[model samples]
Target: MSETPITISNLNDYIFCPASIYFHSLDYYTDTLTYQDSYQINGTAAHNAVDSSTYSDNKNILQSISVYSERYNLFGKIDLFDTDNHILTERKKKVNKIYEGYIFQVYAQYFGLTEMGYRVHKIRIYSMDDNKMYPIALPGENPDMLKKFEVLIKNMNKFELETFTQENIKKCSHCIYESLCSFSRLKE
Candidate 1:
């Protein structure tokens, strides 16, 4: 793998559509094309407290902290880390179902923190919309999923736009970069 680390959040985006990452790298800006849907708007709004690093004043509850795993070559900001209880959480605006992407995100954070000498006994996802917490099993408990996550990291390290294709038409139709992606199958 190259020295450059992969952003942990991009793992979720990669799961959504690899082409979106290519467009994101372009840094496009247009008033009409860059529209924010309700989901996007709500997600941003939900992250405000963590983004501002004011979610909590307690030292045990860390929010919006950067974490990195040199072993996995991954780096990203974690939403919350409870030192007192050794819980790592990734909060979402809402969740209809617990997707693999969500699991991978928190798993990445868990690995990053543990690699950095932190004891993350539990991993979780918090839905701001319903105000519920869902716990995830540790990677060791799920060897198959951990192997898949390892493969994902390896693939991301050598990602190529030409070879990457988003095969899910349903996902393409709802993607924010649908209009911008050349591989997008969404038809107006």
Candidate 2:
């Protein structure tokens, strides 16, 4: 809320739904997510994997796991923070088995936290498939990656949408917001 141009949460808002992004920008971060949420599951898996494999605290590489950058107001959990190496690792989860793109989450973390003066070395994509994990590493603060992420969030923020438009899209498809969206009233 401190006027950072980017944040991990905002990136997620854009990913889920543009309307969600706008609502959050207006300071509406509620408990709309649950344990069964796929996004949570994927992110947790990625975090856990990195927590176990990389960045030993005893070595003085990582100060904390989920670091909150006061400068950019970016809240994100880093996979590995190599303070000694001056590097950071962010985990990205793909919706499909094949790794596509998760730059928004990765770079938003970098761009935001970098504003706070942390040298980010890499953003790793931890792709999941057949109950297995694949590690893909990308350079931190890549202009191409940052630009792509920025464009995405810009689109999400610029759009004006009716709060209830989701109802017409997939209200009957096991949506959590069906009732809140008033889809039930339409059928009645």
In TM-score terms, which candidate is top? 1
Query: In candidate 2, what are the lDDT values of residues 96-126, reduced to their tens digit?
Result: 5422235556555555456667766654444
TM-score, structure 2 vs. true: 0.56
Model 1 has an lDDT value of 0.80
Per-candidate TM-scores read 0.88, 0.56
Q: Least accurate stretch of 10 residues (summed lDDT) in model 2?
A: 170-179
Candidate 1's TM-score: 0.88
Superposition error at 187 for model 2 (Å):
7.3
RMSD of each: 2.6, 5.8
For model 2, the superposed segments whose C-alpha errors exceed 4 Å read 1-6, 20-35, 45-56, 63-77, 92-101, 127-144, 159-179, 182-188
Q: For model 2, what is the alpha-carbon lDDT of residue 67?
A: 54
